[model samples]
Target chain A: MKRLKYILMTLCFSAAGLLQAQESMKSLMDERRENREANYAKWGPTSEHDGMGFIVRAGYVIGGTSPLPLPAEIRKINEFSPKGGFSLGIDGYKYFNMRWGLSAGLRFFMQGMHTGANVKNYGMSIVMGEDIVSGNFTGTDITETRMSGFTIPVMATYRVGARWTFNLGPYFSYWIYRDFDGHVFDGYLREGSPVGQKITISADNPAFYDFSDDMRSCSWGMEFCADFRVREHLNVFGLLDWGLSDVFKDDFQTVTFPMYPIYATLGVAYYY
Target chain B: MRKIFFGLSLAAILGLVSCIQDEPLNAECDIEQAVVVTDDAEAWLLNASEAVQDVPSADTTIVFYLREEFMDENYEGWDRLKDVAINFRLTPGATITPENGSAHDFTQGGVYYHVTSEDGAWQRNYHVMFIPVQPLTVTYDFENFRWESLERYCEWFEYSDQGNEINMWATANPGFAISKSSATPEEFPTIPWENESISGHSVKLETRDTGLFGVMMNMRIAAGNLFIGTFDVANALQDAMAATRFGLPFNKKPLRFEGYYKFKPGEKFQNRTGVIQEGWVDDPDLYAVLYENTDENGQSFTLQGDNVLTHPNIVALARVTDRVHDFDNWTHFDIPFEYYKEIDEERLKTYGYNLSVVFTSSIEGGAFCGAVGSTLLVDEVKVTCEDEDE
Candidate 1:
């Protein structure tokens, strides 16, 4: 009988300890909620509580629309320069809770690049009036690429504490203008194939090639972004857009390689 | 925050630099130089310099001329050539059939060497020959012509009395193909005129517009021309003056240049930039030149379009002075070769002189200044030579 009584007392003590632990855990949760509320309130009237808000963003872009794992035909990049480009956009953010949210935005962006590269056996087709001349070139290629477009991004956002947020999703772009032109110099071109008639191209009389018409009209990509709150209504942001579609049309065979438009942007945003 | 930015920048740069990995193998298969290995090269070759030939990028034939004594059927040099070895300097990593520096029987016409590129993606066939220097025929009938390998256009050639085809004529046809690839063989700047000839087929050279591509390249016109020498198409654009390498080694003294021609000029004479020059009348040109084949240093040399008529090495010249403009009927021209230097009899026997005959529809065609549609028809061209025994 005494052993049964002792077992009952031990069970009661265990139940009481469990209740106390549950009470402490509940208080801890309450404290964290309060802290989160206080942190959100510090962002002034721009910060929304389980609702929707708007943001205006402006950014600078400095990256190239290039091929992934560059092809072997491109032997070396002698020089590279990112021409000045910018992005301006407005985004709508809807919050479900303290941590999870959704964002959709439209942006106008422009990107330009100038590069000099050394290549060997690089196949290309140049526009000559109404016709095209196809050849394999081995020499220095100077290229200039420019693209301007309107982009729409839909993303899932996660808020980290009160000052930082991250988002990632798909983006759709429709190009308004595009240009891809270049010159090949200080080399010899085999007209048609590698074993065809050789034509020497000097620096002063380099061959010009333009593939602007071959560029695609629309491209889709993935965008990853981070925003850091600098003030109550202002935030600094960084974004990376990696194109999943090729820059050229499906039937274009001149470049022989698929190129992507991968760009990174750094900017500031104002929330309201 | 600053550290994060720095790290991201560094990562981007590293990613870019790391994309450049190992380079691809060379895709060019070419024989830059060829040399015949012999105990006494001077005894077997026409000139000691003839043993080694620097092959141009645009040429596929590597020819080494043999001494005149080797032409004798019983000469011992024939046996030596049958077992001769030729060494070739090829593009890096390229491989060749028949083995480099291996002996070959060049006496059986010639040997063909096939070179495969380092990447194994391309191959080029080269014809290497060791033959006695043969002179071209005294008369050109313009009746022998055939389509080139690509069948894009027709090219003119001559045949020896031994029934061997000789590539002694060159034109700007190859260069013209670049601009007007859709043109027919008959539409080319140089074509054989069948109905408009004195007797057999005659050569018709006409200046034609190069079209859109020519405009983009700032080369508005291509004047038809026929010359006795090799046309280096590789330099046709940037250095046109150097493209026309004139002359073939001659073993006899030239006496005169004789030919019959019909000429007609286009309506408007235009400059290279397509600017019409008022009151400018287009004129045809016909000339023959003889010059020393070797410089003072004993290196073989040939005249180019820039210096064919004005070079100090010229020994003789025969040019038509009284041109009959707009002659619809065939006009005869017989101009005597004016000798400026005494002929060295011993050098003449050894093929130490070079001869060239050039005819063009436009006099200033090399400068890209000419009238489109200017036409010149030539027939029965002849080069009279002195007797070898004299």
Candidate 2:
């Protein structure tokens, strides 16, 4: 009971500390916002300048040809076999005023690619004085490049002019799945198999491949869009969102593929 | 005016509440995001283990669950970002207990282990022990299992069809045995039961059409109790297997020589150095020899005697090479164990062992595969000795 009391006390103290820190941070932000408002007040007329209006737009985006070649090309170049999937995203936006608006919508995505091959060669040849077989040598030999993930876009747009709008945004993307496949054919191996088996290996048949949920995680990317309103309710636009950082839950290798799917959406939008 | 002020205050409070960001409506939010956080190191670990098909067959992976709490009443959107740092530690006595009663140390050799951290910024910690074999029943508390350091020998050979086919061979270091019985060819018609199972991973001469290679078992030969079967390369992957010997390599060339020996009576087997190669310079004069002897009944004994061979002897062993490319398919190569006359005499100073046959591979031929790698395989290996049941 005494121990429990101590634990509770410690937790209370921790919560108090967190609260204090948050208060200080909030205070600083409030002060900054006040200063910014004072500066803005100095720059312009305060009377209401614009009325609420509805606008509709439509546009087509020929997304940059994916930097990654087709699955076959990736597989051939890096021996990384790829599984094919499609990614399609459509977004709808509505603005109440020039600076205040909320866009609600969902995106559809499917992506995954992996390639694998077995290593099967062992033994040295006397005649050539070189490795006579295949897949018996072992070192850090990396093969096959694989990549996949899904994204959900949430954004806020500001109309800078009657025909032009600027969007400052954040996207929440969850990598649903990922796969890795490779091969190892080194002569040196643990003494046995998954089950203990001290038998002669017929061949260096080594296969490396994996598929898991571990690859999924939440990531932050930014979207910057400049839309040109062709009509009051219709506009053509281009959206580009680049991944500023990694999507890993831990510190590891940096993902170095297409950071953002830059696409031109050629769909129509309705405003009420 | 006061009423209007009250209304405005109420509106302000409502605005503050509305500005607060909401948490994911689904329980799967964090789980879905979890994949994004998997860093490269974690990916590598997963990939390596997957490559080798090493995974927990059960739900045994350690996990960290995070719950976010908003402290400030005005806590609003993602813009007011909070820096979150999470730390995970291995629980005390953390271990991987396989369903088969086998267990793994999650804090030692990292052979079957790895750790990765990345979820924007990464801070991860993990420890694991990788044993080459399984502990049948002994508890770790008893210190029954010990990690042994082995002086390993790794060599690669390659052969091209364009080169002149050559023959290569080499001898490996020898270790002591707990006990052994000798027998003649007539007495034991078949291979000894003790040597039935061969160590496929054994560092021995290999013939891959053109290239000759060698690998020596620098560690204790495990799983020899039921009988000293041939070394099994496949089983050594597990931690249960035992080690054999330790020593550095001296000869850079594939060992190839020929010699003869006859069994004697009432002699004890012990470690000894065989004859040295003829043309090769005897800088330290290193060679490998098998100890053998006979009993009063004329039965030959090839078991080790008291005096142990020095580590220097094992380290001094080397491969002899005439032409680097003189290594091809299995061509008969022999070594006269008596070649190391001085070393053999030293063995006479102790107890004399005889050489029945010799093995070798092209030790000098040093070429590499164009793209594909290579490996060596040995099957149906036998040792001839004098006849005797015990």
Candidate 3:
């Protein structure tokens, strides 16, 4: 009976200690929140990202360079043709109601795509960078392109049941890398095209067309995304980055067709 | 978690539904406009006393008809010459041969003009022939031809006629394949696929898929073709009406087009949208057009893909009816011309008409449709006259 009594007392002591430690941790956490609130009240926010959110994404960017207001044909996204890319950024949110909030973030999109096609006398114009000229081409030929950029998005978000979240907004992007490269061996280009002859354009011929500058410095588009909370501080998400602005400059008529960048991002987020 | 899952699913559906395929850019270079300058009081072309055809088309060709009175005594004792200094007005940044503004020696009958496109990537040659209007019936047997090479770029074959070499026979061969294969004309576009006693050598025209470039532009196939007139690169992307000239200036009222041909259409048909039309059988095109070569302004009219067969200027035309032909044997075709109006023999003998004989492995290839493997082998192409009967 004495031994039993000793065990019970020891268990009670341990429980007390655990409770005390929990109280201390809670206090510390509350103090930190208070400090954050105080700082927010005292100084203005400096970042466009939501005042308290972050996301890290690793997913394929599924899209192609196309004319604006994409056509039905482009709408049929080839699920297999998506390219590898990534997204990482922080955001700030302002909740107005139980289910209504606004958020903005500064993010970088490292996305790219490479697709192959067999067109018959594809009648179109090709334009390269500054050293430029537009030319028509027909016959069989092959081409590939890659692109990446930095983006800023402003979104309207809705939260449901404390575990579900949805966001829709417009995104602005500035490209850091751009390329439209390939070969024209099987067809003929009209005289006066930047690449004057029926020619092969590979890395070997640095003289090949580089359309990097032909891309617009700034682009804007609409997007929609959703997030599912996995833990108090962690969530998994998927997003769409739909561009509204043309990918080329206004005067750059070579790529006469209006094209925009529309892509998707699937990833995870750690938020405060 | 269930609500979150539902929301995510809804978003995914929206994303996919809102997505679309991008429209392709224009990647062609074609002559948008062409004109001839002169050294008369206003220094103009088409201003000669008897000049008829004047304004130029996007084909980079400028035709000027003279009254046979302007034949220069210095250059041609056999005929009078148009003593006007001729220049050119073409797409900005474009250049001309015989040096724009230089006096042309029309005494030799036909003066050749070469227009170098603004980008210096394409060139179109024109034959400015000044001859007394007469019956013209021509035949091509794929003989007496020579291939000219542009080093690693391209090569083309020329026809020898009228005591001179004619650059009239043009194929998209050099323009399409040379850049990638870096091949010469001897092996690239024409291989003289076969030789038959009736004609000697049959010209084989084959289509090819442009390797990497084809993928980028969505223009996958390059159909084999043989036709009269020049291929203007400038209009290829911007205007379908100006893309391919289906006819050339001719003064003859032809009654028939006789030729031996072998054909096999490609298995797939690819439209401008890049969709493969499965089970779509491609057909070879064998047709000709005879139209008023000059307009009221005395400007020469050249039929392009848009209006070739349907132009109001058409006076007569013909086309082969057989689409299915034996591959192992040459199929003889004799298509008679159908007249829309009575032949004005006198007017026809006065440079009043133009004709075109176009052959393609794919009938809709010019509009960006056809299978890649389509083939057309032709030999002993002849155009007979109806002088006595008509």
Candidate 4:
């Protein structure tokens, strides 16, 4: 009975100490929350309240408008280079809570690439005045593609910590300018089909082709973005835009495969 | 923090770069080369080089010229072509019908071969023939023409006394079709004109603009031309001067060349770059050349546009020096062959010489320098030969 009494007294003392520790922990958490709220109130645009805010972002874009798995007609890639384009956007966000938000943004971006590839029996068409010369070409092709457009993105956002936010959603783009042009050198073309008459194109006298009009005017795709807060109102962000639609229109058959526009951007975002 | 941001950016970029994978199976079907493997190639072929031929990407016909003696119907060697084996080099992963290296009777006509791509999505047909070397006709009326290349252009051919079609004439019509595929038969650089003629339809040659394609290639104009040899379309864009292989094998001596023609100069003459040349006028060209077909080393030789008149092996030349400006009336021209080198009588009987008769709308057309609307009409051409005594 004496030993049981001693054990009960020790357990009571331990429970009191644990209660005091819990009280201190709760107070500490409350103080941090108050400080965060004070900071949010001071910076109105960066607040986590249920209100609207805007952000402006600028970044460099680098990627290609290319066919998936590259068709067999392309025998080799001789050279490839990104044309060094940029993206600029303004986004409006509505925070539902500290962990959830929605954002809609309008962006203007440019994407371009230059490539040299060796192709065999590749289908193509070239404009000669009023005529469209369709043929299968077997030779070296040097191509350049450039596109500039305005995009509207609607995304759902999730905030993990005070400094991290993730965004994913669909984006619609309206292209104002598009260009897909190239030259075929040191090769031969079979007019009309693979079995058609052969016309040789020399390096000095390369055949030129432009398919700018065949590109689609509007495109929709998905974008994934992650933003890391670097300052009170500044963030470093990375975004990946994956195109679900083809770069060319449906009726365009000169390009044997469907080409998609895929790009990634890394830049800074300023909250206002 | 900066390191983390860079890490994420680098990873995203790397992912994008890795999207391109290995290429798939070949989608083209073609015969790159063709050859006849024989035990005695020298006895069967006219020349050793004739045993193998590198096929152009655009060509579907493979022709092998045989020795004249072997081509005789009564000769036993004529039957040997039935058992000869032929081999072909095809595009990778391509299969051919009747199998490669299979023997076929080429003495009857051209043997057809169909090639299918590895992916089985594309196919091409080829015609292979072994025939005797053909001879040029002595007279031309410019009355025979047919629509060729899916009816895209007009091609002229002759008929022998035996009523067999003789393909002894060539033109730049096929080359023009590359740039102007939608052009009508009458809009072509060379066409059969039914308006005026000595007896039948006359040949009309015109200088035409090659459109944007021509400007891009620095060959702005395509001048109409007719010749007694082959126009190698394979080299038409690369080396145009070498594309025109002039002359055909001839055993007789030509004394004179006679023809009727009407010519009109275009309003503005231009250089190769399509820039107008001040005070310059375009003129038509009519010429005949006879040259040794074999060099001193016994190798076969033929004249091209660059050296048809300047080669040291030339035996004779009959070129019109007078410029004809009349467009309304036909002018008759008869010129005697002027000799530059002595003829080898024994070699002449063995087909050692080659003769070519050429007509062009513009004299400098070979260099892509001409006027756009220059036209030349020609008809009733004849080549008179010397008697055996002379």
True contacts kept of each: 0.40, 0.08, 0.12, 0.51
Report the C-alpha lDDT of model 1 over B282-325, residue by residue, as the tens digit: 98899999999999998999999889999989999999988787
Question: For model 4, how big is the CA root-mean-square deviation?
Answer: 3.6
> Model 2, residue A252: what's the lDDT?
24
In model 4, how large is the Cα lDDT of residue A46?
A: 38
- For lDDT, candidate 1 versus 4, the one ahead is 1
Which residue pairs clash in candidate 1? Answer: none
Q: CA lDDT of each candidate?
A: 0.85, 0.29, 0.60, 0.84
lDDT of 4 by residue, A148-263 (tens): 99989899987766677889999998989999998899998877877676778889878777889899999999998888877877988888788889999997877878898877
Give the per-residue lDDT of model 3 (tens digit) for B1-390.
Answer: 434544654464345446544544333333333334433411222223333333323333444444333333343323324454554555556666777667666656567777675546556676665443222337877664554443432323344333434556656664454223433444443346545425567777766665444444445566677777666543343343364676655666688888888887766777766688888888888887788876777655678877888888899888998776567777889989999988887766555677777888878777667787788888888877656333
Where in model 1 is the C-alpha error above 4 Å?
A: A1-18, A41-50, B1-10, B13-17, B57-61, B388-390
**Backbone clashes (count) for model 2:** 152
**Best-fitting candidate, scored by TM-score:** 1
Off by over 4 Å in 3: A1-272, B1-83, B87-137, B149-162, B177-191, B195-197, B296-298, B388-390
Task: Sort by DockQ, best first.
Answer: 1, 4, 3, 2
Across A146-244, the per-residue lDDT of candidate 3 in tens digits comes to: 677778889998765456678998888887777665444434443444234333222222123445667777888897878777776677777778777
Q: What lDDT is reached at residue B148 by model 2?
A: 13
Instruction: List chain A TM-scores, every candidate, in order.
Output: 0.87, 0.39, 0.64, 0.82
Candidate 2 TM-score versus the reference = 0.28
Model 1, TM vs. native: 0.92
Q: Which ten residues in a row have the lowest lDDT in candidate 2 chain B?
A: B25-34
Q: DockQ of each model against the real complex?
A: 0.47, 0.04, 0.08, 0.46
